[model samples]
Target: MIARLGDTEQTLDLPPGYTLVALRELGDAFAHAREIAAEAGAGTLVWVRRYDLVEFAVVLEPDEPLASARRAFFAGMNALADAIAAHCPPEREVAFDWPDAIRFDAGLLGGGRLAWPNDCAEDEVPSWLVFGVILRAAAMAHVPEVQAASGVSLLSEGFEMVETDAIIESFSRHLMTAFDRWKERGFEAIARDYLERLPQRKAGERRGIDVNGDLLVRLAAGNAAPERNSLVDALARASWYDPQARGPKFE
Candidate 1:
């Protein structure tokens, strides 16, 4: 993969240990990364150069079992929202819908997806995990009032100066920072940062990722300890992805 900027396409400057693979405007960065992650190894960043969406994927080799490794997805999502917030114009609300959807000011702005080897078992350590990201940088058509009311693009949401390269670079940097914190502190650090950005939780309901990545929702009071949300189940299908169009679903 090769990255194309504007008129003259070039590789975006990535941090050390990161290999940049740039794809054409129409290439699917996520699919390609998923296909090649086993061989690509860690620190590989696959990016697609397109006008409308900033699409990319990263390869990671986790030191833990597949079950616990999936918790990294939460950290990745947190870093993504942080990267966007870093460049966001002041006071524009950014949040997550749950396990994996990102919204800005109550409008959809695309989200993330995770993939691993199909044969990998929960107890086994997979060869690699591919975390893919897509962000709507521009609206492809004339967004109707109703549709626009529920979704928005970066340009539509006051991000005129923001570009795909900048976001990707920022995400890589932030992801590194997030991982470092997780290593130094623990998953609690990642969970705290992520839960803080979650849209609206019922008051007194605290949420956190379990040892195996399942969502643990605990009430502040009552003997009602509710059932857990299986993170594996939630990530089995991308909630915000549109299978028919092979892109994000909005409205």
Candidate 2:
């Protein structure tokens, strides 16, 4: 069942026993979904009502533990980036800033987040996982002068015709494609797709994903030391997301 909070029309595509809820712009999809994820089960998509930002979260029931399943966030982020790039103006650059931030022409747009049951251990099944995402469709209204230089919007960046529904639809399809690639071609294929979206560094620098999902960068100076940041720990603290403002921080 689809529930509407305010003008927001959030729909849940439940596969029989699941329930869906929609919230207004004031609603926190990630926190709300995570709060009731256990009972909501799978197939729950909670979305917020915001024209300037495409905000939503999905619920998943994975068979793996939290640590391994967290990598799944990368799959979602990759697909989310792909969805944005599809409609991006040709030659417009889009790259990821480390683990969880997406940038367009070096400007902050939006990013994704993850959540699970509080008591669930890294080795235990958390019951359900919530993969949340947001996109800056348009610039916010009347921002402070100092903050103006930091934030950006798709409209300002030449993505004029994009819409919230279109992004969400494309994201769902791309996410499924990500999963298929992960299953058929293997995680390496998924990693390659994600890595390709990242902006290239200096000439001759190479990048690869380690087994644990840390970004391994190989510089041209004959340096092979891998930048081994744990994916699980990194995701725990989203660098781009600002909880107080309910959006990304442009620094």
Candidate 3:
């Protein structure tokens, strides 16, 4: 992994077992990575050169079945959080909203996404998995006055000192740390890290993540039962992201 990725095309000489695929800002790293993942195999990082957002995707080859392996999303999310927090001013708040929205001081920063072979079955080994992430380093569009109160960017949040390449490099290293921790400590550890980053819930409210990565929230009412949000279904409908628009939305 590089501590700094130079602008030159040849600046990305990665370590063995890793393949580097660079794309112009116009390219979609996530879609491209997924398209090439089966042939590229693990450790393939598809990175796009963009200043407004640090967008990239990595190829993963999981040994576990798709159902159990979906937990990898937590690892990526945790690493993404760590990467952002590293540059955040002390005490500046950052948190997650359920499955995939990330917020900073209660304002949106960006989120993560997961993709696997469409034909993958719960019991079958996914041919490949791609973990994609985007972080707002600079605001590309003006938030409407009404929505401005709920939106944020790294620059506005006192993270203007952070550069896009630095975030991606930090993410790659932290992602490796997260994966190692998950491999040794199990998905429980990964889930705990992810949940800890979520916004504080109401008092007496309990939250837990399901085996398949759904969010389970329980209110402390009599006969209270956990309500489950289908992570797979929600993620499939639409990403919280808009590639063409170049940002996220409340939708």
Best by lDDT: 1
Better of 1 and 3 by lDDT: 1
Candidate 2 stretches greater than 4 Å from native: 6-20, 200-206, 218-225
Clashing residue pairs, backbone N/CA/C < 3 A, model 3: none
Q: For residues 38-147, could you state the per-residue lDDT of candidate 2 as single tens digits? A: 88888677877676677888888877877677777789988888878888889877788777888988888888888877788978866888999877776655456567
**Top candidate by TM-score:** 1
Ranking by TM-score: 1, 3, 2
lDDT of 3 by residue, 1-251 (tens): 43234555523444456777888768788989999999999989998877677788999999989987888888888888898888788998778876787888887788888999989899998988999987777656455655544557687677764455667677778888998898898878898899899864687777778888888888877666788888888767545676557566643
Poorest 10 consecutive residues of model 2 by lDDT?
11-20
Backbone collision tally, model 3: 0
Q: Residue 162 in model 1: shift from native, Å? A: 4.3
Q: Runs in model 3 with CA error above 4 Å?
A: 1-7, 10-17, 141-150, 220-223
lDDT of 3 at 126: 93
**Model 2 per-residue lDDT at 151:** 76
Q: If scored against the real structure, what TM-score would every candidate get? A: 0.92, 0.85, 0.87
